[model samples]
Target: MAATRACLVALVVALTFLFMEGRVTAEPTSAGSLVQRRREMGSLLRRLNKPPIASIQSPDGDVIDCVHISKQPAFDHPLLKNHTIQMRPSYNPRGMHHDSNITTHAITQIWHQNGTCPENTIPIRRTKEEDLLRASSIRRFGKKMPRSIPHLNPTNDTDTPNILRGHQHAVASAQYDKCYGTKSTFNLWKPWIARGNDFSLTQFWITGGSYNGNNLNTIEAGWQVYPNLYSDSNTRLFIYWTRDAYQSTGCYNLLCSGFIQTSNQITIGGSISPMSTYGGTQYDIDILVWKDQAGGNWWLQVGGDYVGYWPSSIFSYLADSASTIMWGGEVFSPDAGQTSTHMGSGHFPNEGFGKASHIKNIQVVDSSNCLNPTSDVGFITEQNNCYNVQSDTYGDWGTYIYYGGPGNNHNCP
Candidate 1:
C-alpha cells in the first residue's frame, strides 16, 4: 500500500512538470509557472525581433522586417563581435556559367508581391509569441536535434540506424579528397506532413569531419515545410550550420548569430510561392555554396543573389574544405512507428520528372576553384519501400537524382 502511494505521487509530479512546460494537458499548470514561461518567451522574442527600418506584411501573413545589415542577429555572437561582413565573395568559382540551351523558370517569394527590402538592409521573418508556444521549450526553438544529418557513406544501402532515429533521407552524395563548393537546382513542392511536429524538406549538406565524434561541421540550405517550427504549413527557405554535429551552435535561418546576411532581396525564413503541382508546371531554386579561399568564408548564392555566408572562423574542419556533399529529401517523424508525412513531392522516384521531385546539375568545386560535374555519386535511404532515390545523367541536366515518396503506405507501414 505504501509503494502504490509513492508511485501515485511520482506520477503526479511528472504530470505537473509536463503541464508547466506546455507539453501535456494532463493537469492544469500553476499561475506562477505559466507567468514565468510567458516572461521567458517574451524575452526571447524581443531578442529575435530586432527593430526594423521598414516592415512589409506578406500576403501569406508573414511580416518581413528590413533590419539594417549591421544590426542583424549575426553580430550577436561573441566570436563575431569584431567581425566585418563581406559584401561579396572575393572570388567566384571558375566555370560557373549556366547552359544557354537549358530553359529556366522564374521563382520568387510571396512577400515580394508587396515590396522588397531596401538596399543595405536584410529581410528577416519576424518571430512571434505563438511561434515560441509551438516549440516543446524555448531552448529547443529553431534548432534541429543532435545527429540530424544522415550518415556519411553508410556501410549498407539500407541505413537502418537513421530509420531508428525517426529521420529518413533519399540523398546523393559525393566524397573527394577536397571539396570547396557545390551547386544544384532542387524541384520545389509542398509535400504533406502527417503531424505538426513532422517536417518535409529538400536540401543539400556540405559536411566535414567525423560523424562519430561531435566535431562534424555542416552547412545546409534548403526549403522546408515545418508547421511546428513556423506555426504554419507553408514552405519556407532556410539555412543551418553547426560545428559540433548539431549538439549545439547552430539554428535554422537567422534564429542564431553565426551566418551573416548580405542579400536585401531574399528573406531567410520567408514563405516560397507557386509550388509545383503533380504532373504540371514545375518550379525550382538554384542553391550554390562555395568557399572563398581568400577570405575563408563559405558563401551561399540563391539564384543570382549572394544571400550571406558562414564565416570560416566558426568551423574547425570546414574552415579549410568540405569532405562530402549530399543533396536530397528528408522527412522527420517523432513517433516510433512510421508517419504519414510525405517526402519530396509525395511520389516515388520511379514516377520521373513532372511527377517526382529532383535535384539536377549536381556539381562540385575542385581544388582549383573550378566547378565540375560530380563523378562516382551514390544514393542512400532508410526505407526503400516508403521512399527511394535514383540517379542518372542527361543532356543539359548533366548529373541529377530523382527521389522521395509517400510515407506510411501499405508497404511502408
Candidate 2:
C-alpha cells in the first residue's frame, strides 16, 4: 500500500508539471491548488474583455477626451496582429458660435484667403482722413460746401424773395402770350428787369394757361435766376409755389416744357392742372430748376425722378461759372412755328398772366460737390422739409430781402 501511494504521488507531480507548461493534463491531485489556478484563469479572461485606452487632440492643440477600448486588443499585443488600431478620436464634434477673441486683422486675413466673408460676419473699414474733412466742411457751411452740393436741403421761411418777377413776366409774355391767352408784350432790356451779378430776383408770379385747344401753356411760374443776362437762356435757381392744388399737373408740365432749354438757366414755371396722367393725383404747387449740362445740354428732375434731357446745341451760349447769373420770369421758344401750338406767338390767353401762386422756401445747392447729403434730394422744397425751421431754415432758403414772413416775403415790391 505504501508503494501504491508513492506511485500515485509521482503521477500527480508529473501532471502538475505538464499543466504549468500549457500541455493537456489529467485531473489535479490538490483541490486547493486547482481552485487557485481556476480563479487566476478567470481573472485573465476578464482582463482580455476590458477596452484599450486612446488619447485624442483638439484642433487647437488641446487634449480633449480619452477613450478606453475594453473589447479590442492592445495596440502592441501579439494576438491582435490581424487587427488595426482603429483609434476613433473622442471629441465634442459639434458646431459652436465662437465670437471671442475676434480681431480685425484676423478677419481681413480670412477674407483674403476665402475671397468672401463667412456667415454672419460683417466687414468694416476705417474712414479716411480726407472723407472726414469733407464731411466736416459740409456741416460747417451747409450747402455752401462743394462736396455737399447734390444733397442740398430745401429752405423754409417763405418770406424771402429770391425770384425776379419782372424778368420772368417779360420772357413769358414774349414767348407764350398767345398760347396763354394774353396779349402783353415783354421788354427784355428794362433796367429794373435786368439780372444782377448774383442773379437773384423777387417780384414774379406763377402762371397757368392753355394753347390751341390743348392745355400746353401749363408751368410752375416764378422768377428764375440764370447764369447770364440779355437772354432768357440759362439760370441757376428758381423759386415758385408750393400749394398742393396747383402743383400736380403744373409741376410735371413745366418739367416737360422747361427741360427743352439748353443752358445753365434755372426756369420757374407751373400750371393749374388738377390731375396728372403720370399717376392719377394732383400735385402740390412746386418750382423747378433746369440745370444746363456742358453743351447746351440740360437735365430735368423733380423730387427724385429724372424727367428728361436736352441736347447741347440749343443754347446761344453756355454759362461756365456759377457767378454769371441773370434773373427773369418767363421762358421763350426760339422755334415758334413748331408742331406744338404753344411753341411760338406769346399772346396765348394762358401765357402772360402774372398771378401769384402759393410760394414757399428757396433752395441753394453747390453742383461742384458730388456727395449727396443725408436729406431727401427730391423733396427739399416741400413744406416741413427743413431739419430745423428756426435756425437751419435761413441756411437752407436764405434770409428775406425785406420782411420775414412766409409766402409774402418771396416777392420784392
Candidate 3:
C-alpha cells in the first residue's frame, strides 16, 4: 500500500509540471496570434478606407496627387508619397472651407481652368478720386517736352553780315543800313545801337512790312552771343531794343512777332504769331541764367520762357570777342523774294504802325525760380493771362507769357 501511494504522488507532481509548462508556452503563442490578426485587420481596413490616387489638372499644367504606404509593418501608412506630394486644388484647407458646398471636382476644375489655384484669386479695386487727381496731374505736368534744337557751330565776325543782313531782308521784308545809337528813345529808322567798345550796334537789326500801306511792321534783330563769348572775364554786356506806340494798336505786337537765337544755335522760345499783345504796351526780351547741379554747369535761358536754353559752352561763344552780334533784321537768312517787296511797301499805320516793345522789369532767378506759378490754374488761365499780361488783338498768346511773367502784374491787357 505505501509503494502504490508513493507512485501516485509522483504521477500527480509530473502532471502539475506538464500543465504549468503548457500554460506558459501557450500564453505567448496565443497572444502573438491575436496581435498578428489585429495587424492584418488594421492593414485591410486602411486599404479599404484609402483614397485613390488622383490626377489634377491646372491651366498652367498637370500634376498628380498620390497615396503611398510603407512595406514595413512597423511603419504607419502615409496618404501621400514621401517628398513626392504636390500642391493640388483639393488639398488647400482654406479653399476646402470656403467651397464646402461645392463639389471637389468642380473646385479642382475651377482652379485648373483658371490656370492658378482659386485661393490666389484677387479682385482689382477701382481707382479713387485722389488717385485720379494725382494721375491727371502727372499727365498734365510730369512729363517734360524734349529739346527741339541742337547746338550750332560757332559764328565769326564775317558770318554776322551774311546771317544778320540776309535775315533782315527776309525777316523785315526790306533792306536798311545798320547803325548804332544810345538814345533810349524809340526810332523807326536807324533802330539799332552799339553799347560800349566791347559790344556793337551791329548786334541789333530791325525788319518789318507795311500792312495795307498803313501799319509799319517790324521785328528786331540781334546776334546770338556765341557759346564761347560768355567765358570772357571782361565781357559784361547789356543789349536793349525798343518798341513805341502811336496808339494802343500801333506798338509792335510782341504776341504777333518775336524770335531769338541761342548761342548754341537753338532758337529760344518766341511767337510766330500773337500769343499775347496789348498794342500800346512795351514788352522786353531778356536773358536769364541757370545752373545744373550735376555738373556745376551754367545755362542761359532766352525769352524768360523755358522754350530756349543755352549751355555754358554756347554762352561762351556769345561772349567771345571774335563774333559780331547782330540784332533787329532777321539774324538768320532772309525769306526768299519777300525782302525787297517788304521794303518797298513801307507804310506806317497811324493806328497800328511802329510801336515799341517796352521792358518793364528785369530779374535773375535760378531754374527753380523759373517755375510756372499758375501751372494748376487750368487751360483758361494758362491760355490767357497767367503771365500777368493781357491778350493781343489777334486773341492768341504764346506759351512764353505764362512762363515769362511779371508774376502778379496785368500791365498788358
Candidate 4:
C-alpha cells in the first residue's frame, strides 16, 4: 500500500508540473503578442472585404473612373471626442450664432482683442464681397466640358440662392485644437427639389488659417454635399475651397491650378449613391483632411486613398498653424419664395435614422502631433430657424451627431 501511494503522488506532481509549463508557453512573447495578433487579423479582414475600385464620373459628365483607390477610415487614428470646441464671443455671439455673414467686410476686423487674438491663438480673416465676386467669376473645370455648363458656387452672394434649409453650426474649439488633423463622418444625404430650379443642398465649413489686419483670407475646405449641382438628379460629390475666402484664386479640386491633385483615382464631384452601405455599422462618408506638417499643403483623404492636396501657397492662413476650424452645414437658397429645396435628408436632426444628415467622429490633430479626442464642448448657430444639431453617444462609435431639417415647412417662406 505504501509503495502504491508513493507512485500516485509522483504522478500527481508530474501532471501539475506540466500544467505550469503550458501556462508559461501560452503567455505572449515580445514578438508574438496580442497586438500583433490583432494587427494580423485586421490586415486579413481588410483584404477579404476590400471594396472594388470605384467607377466614378467626373462633374463634366465624363466617364473618369480610371484608378482603384482603397477606402481609408475617417482619421489616421481612432477619433475620440475628448475635447469640445472653444468658441470665442465674436465667432458665436448671442449663444451660437456664428458669423454666417462673415464674408462681409463689416465683419473683417477681428472682434477678439482687435485681431491680435490672445497668445497661442491665430488671427481670423473675414472675406470681403469684392474678393468673393472675383473668385466666382472664374471657372476651372477639371476636364474640357463637352459644352457650356453653368458656373458652380457663385462668388456673388446675390447670385447664390438659399432654397435649401438654412444652417446653424455646432463648431469646435481651437484653444484645445492644437491638434494636427480634424475629421468627421456623415451619411450622404440626397436632397430632392423641383425639376427646373437648382435644388439647394448641404455644405459644411472646415475654416482655418492665419488672419492679418489686412488680407482677410482664411483657407476654407470642406465637402459640399450637393446633388444636382451639375444639373443631374444623381447624388454627386461637390468639393469646395476658398484660399482667400472664396476669392477667384482657389476653386474646387482640380478645377483651378493652385490645388494640385496627386492621385488620378479620386473623382472630384464623384457620385456616391445608396449613401449608406450595410454590414455592421451604418454607411457614411469617412473623410480626414489635414495639413501636411512640413509642406503646409492641405491634403484630403476620402475613405482610405490619398486622393490629393491643396498646395500651401493657395492659403495664407492654412499654410501655417491655423487658428480656427469650423465644422457645420450650409445650403444656397436660390429664391426666397422657393422652399421645396431641402438642405440635408429633408428632416430635422432630432428626426434621427435615415432622414437626417450628420458630421460624426469629430476629432482634431493636437499640438502633440497626435489625434486626441477634444473636450469642453460649445454648440449652437445663427439661424436655429433653419436647422439644429444634437450630439449623442453611439455605443462603441463614440459621440456622433444628428442634424438637418426640411425647407419651406417651418414658417420659412
Candidate closest to the true structure, highest TM-score: 1
Among the numbered candidates, top lDDT falls to 1
Clashes of each: 0, 62, 62, 36
Residue 113 lDDT (model 3): 38
The TM-scores, one per candidate, come to 0.91, 0.21, 0.20, 0.56
Lowest lDDT 10-residue stretch of candidate 3? 89-98
- For model 1, residues 1-413, the per-residue Cα lDDT tens digits are 78755744654565565456544334235645555666777889988999999999998989999999999999999899999889999999987647568667888999999998999899999998668766766777899988778888465334357778889988988888889989988899999988777899999999998666688999999899998788789989999999998988899999988999999999998898778999998888899999999999999999998999999999999999999999999998875238889999999999999999999888898888898988588888878888889999887788899999998888985
Off by over 4 Å in 1: 1-28, 153-160
**Global lDDT of model 3:** 0.21
Q: All candidates' lDDT scores?
A: 0.86, 0.23, 0.21, 0.42
Clashes of 1: 0
Tens-digit lDDT track for model 2 on 117-215? 222221211112222122212122111111111111125222222122111121111121111111111111111212121122222222222212222
Q: Residues 295-363, candidate 4, lDDT per residue (tens digit)? A: 555666666545555555555656565545545554443343434555566666776665566666566
